[model samples]
Target chain A: MDSEYKKEDFLLLFGSRIDIIRRKKGYSYERIAQGCNIDGSDISKISKGRVNITLSSILELSKGLDIHPKELFDFEIEA
Target chain B: MDSEYKKEDFLLLFGSRIDIIRRKKGYSYERIAQGCNIDGSDISKISKGRVNITLSSILELSKGLDIHPKELFDFEIEA
Candidate 1:
């Protein structure tokens, strides 16, 4: 993560969005990661905003989650 | 952008992906920005990976582009 990028900024925001989408789709991180051929720990990290994902991973996760990657940013969190 | 995120890495990668998607859908940045209600400059920055966008903007752009956000990351660029 960039020192300029507060963990609270992108991570929490990204995590919350991922959480909402995952719940809406009824998918576990493990299941989604498996389908996307990525590690479950990585997915967990992503959902928690601990990792910054590549565009490719984002696409794979979307496919696994059955959501538009844009939905990952649908919710707003106050800074 | 994160110092950890090399401009050449994410920017080029994201840019190429966006370029591919935009071309595939025949969308100009102006049209997408207008549809998404974001600044055209901002959209240009994003396509070039010069700025790190919020999840909300990502969602909006996806809607405007008529693409699953995941498709934005479908292309791979060599680091």
Candidate 2:
């Protein structure tokens, strides 16, 4: 369904924000993964836009990074 | 650059939100495109996760939809 496409898009966006916040917080992939209970390799892949992550993982990452989940999408790229 | 991947992820997430809001508002792709001054085909591609859009386009789409730009990233997909 078309909705599936939309879901994928959302995941990609959310994943990117997670990567930005991680770097901004000065946390490495392993640190974030250990803190968030997610796989470090998956974090690396997600940061590189090679993997899609779940909403639960996003929440965990948010908690780990001390950022509001919404802040991830707050800044926009110029394109 | 890694930043490029993050940017792409943001665009994808923003685009997905546009698609969800458009459907919720009962608007067609063409209608949103016409109102937002973006190419309809681009809207279609963006919605389908095939195209990356600029932040300006996201703002225009938000204006056309009467939805807060932040709302697009408000809801998280289950993954």
Candidate 3:
């Protein structure tokens, strides 16, 4: 599209948001992994924007963090 | 996890939300398709919760809808 942001940028921002939330909650990747199928190492990769996480992953992450999935996407994106 | 809702439910809810937004905007799937890689048919599948869309697809859908990606996930998910 004509937008300035690319898919990669969006993924990076999403990952950063996850990192921020987990850190704020004092939850390690292992802690988050306890509630989901993803490995703690995979969570780390996802937090680093290394994974193209799916909708299922989103649910897993939210369940892991015990928060609404929408919270993960609660970050700014210029219109 | 022990939550009542499953990943499938989340996908269904998310798809419903997209349908709500697109309809509210008076946008057809074809119209949304014009701005992203997803086809109108795929959008139809997604709206029906038949597709487990990826993060990139989320970005494409947001671009297609001309809204923040977060808006796509703006739905209530019970704890």
Candidate 4:
């Protein structure tokens, strides 16, 4: 497929978006991780774009943050 | 977290949505997999809710189907 969206590009953008959301809510990675029943390191990895996160993890993060799942997915794309 | 959204429920809904999109686009798993350079078995697994697919994969599917990424993420929630 003639696609312009690279995997790493999307991952980085997604990570940055999550980080922004986390900061906006004043929630640390550890706190969010504990609330979501996920490891802090995994959350860190996701924020660092070092690992691929599952859909369950994404929704769990939203649940932990007391936000809607769609909010987690809301991001502006420049690419 | 008071999430009425269960992990299994979302996965099933997601898989079903993807399946519906595939059918609506008139594209088979094999054809889509071939177009996106993904394995047909993996596509089947995603559609069957037997595996967790990455965000990149979901985007690649949209690319393969000649649609937007947001469209892949779109679904009418009945829960």
Candidate 5:
């Protein structure tokens, strides 16, 4: 289904999906942040839909999770 | 190999990949932007490595390109 998303909806869905992926990989936000060398607070914000997550951020997050970057997009994300 | 990237290298690679995808889809920057309801100038800038492209932006771009978001990460991106 082609769903139109506002930036807010998009961010919310992205955060939820990232949260799911982090949990599935058995990583705490702090651990993943450490792996990514990003701030833990920033990771928490990203997971809570409080920031505009960049492509580089996704790549770093996937790297931290030890998964293909594409795997991050492999789910249905609800707004 | 785990490629540790600077933000600049990351942006360049992301732009290159986006350009490759846009071309593979036979889309001009204008048309895809139209489809995504985004600014054409911004799309052009994105392809030029001038933006810190967001996850939501990628989703909209994939929608515009009529491809899976995962497809955007299908190739190896060089710095």
Candidate 6:
């Protein structure tokens, strides 16, 4: 449950999840950037949990990955 | 793919998804507010697609709903 985690924790986890997914698809930050409005540097920062990105950014990331937006939230929240 | 939609569209969809989930759980705005930092009125605005909420807010909403954050994003994007 999300109750067990702080907001930053979830952001960090979501970032890593994005990292994993992008890597799995063999996408470079530039590659992802080419597909969306986000810059490659921003994507790097996001993957490191440095960005408190909004829902629109999430949608852009999903577009960059060519995946469903829900997939970005697919990582597990450990207890 | 998220490429089919704009940022506002995703926000609206995400908002509606939250509305659906809260209704399914029989959680009113006040009920959810009691579980998180968000005010009931803000939740209403968020549900109406009027807020471009950050990652932290999403976490709080998930906590309020006692659900995984991914569940908040489980709706389909129609073409």
> What i-RMS does every model get?
11.5, 11.4, 2.3, 3.0, 2.5, 1.4
Q: Residue A53, candidate 6: how far off, in angstroms? A: 0.1
Top-scoring candidate (DockQ): 6
All DockQ scores: 0.08, 0.08, 0.63, 0.44, 0.53, 0.78
- Best-fitting candidate, scored by lDDT: 6
| Recovered fraction of real interface contacts per model | 0.02, 0.09, 0.64, 0.40, 0.57, 0.84
Q: How displaced is residue B20 in candidate 3, in Å?
A: 0.3
For B1-79, candidate 4 gives per-residue lDDT tens digits of 4556777877777788779888998989888886685788888888877777777776677667766555655764443
For candidate 2, the C-alpha RMSD (Å) to the true structure equals 10.7
Question: In what order do the candidates fall by lDDT, top score first?
Answer: 6, 3, 5, 4, 1, 2
RMSD of each: 9.8, 10.7, 1.6, 2.8, 2.9, 1.3
Better of 3 and 5 by TM-score: 3
Q: Which candidate achieves the best TM-score against the true structure?
A: 6
Query: What does the lDDT read for residue B50 in candidate 3?
Result: 85
Regions of model 1 farther than 4 Å from truth: A1-7, A77-79, B1-79
Give the lDDT of residue B17 in candidate 6.
98
DockQ of candidate 2 is 0.08
Off by over 4 Å in 5: A1-3, A77-79, B1-3, B77-79
Q: Which stretches of candidate 4 lie over 4 Å from their true place?
A: A1-4, A76-79, B1-4, B76-79
Quote model 4's TM-score: 0.79
Q: Record all residue pairs in model 2 with backbone atoms less than 3 Å apart, i.e. clashing.
A: A13-B9
Across residues B1-79, which tens digit of lDDT does each residue of candidate 5 receive?
Answer: 1647566766777678889988887899888877786688998888788888887788888777777777777766442
In the predicted model 5, the residue pairs found to clash are: none
Scored by lDDT, model 5 comes in at 0.75
The clash number for model 1 is 3
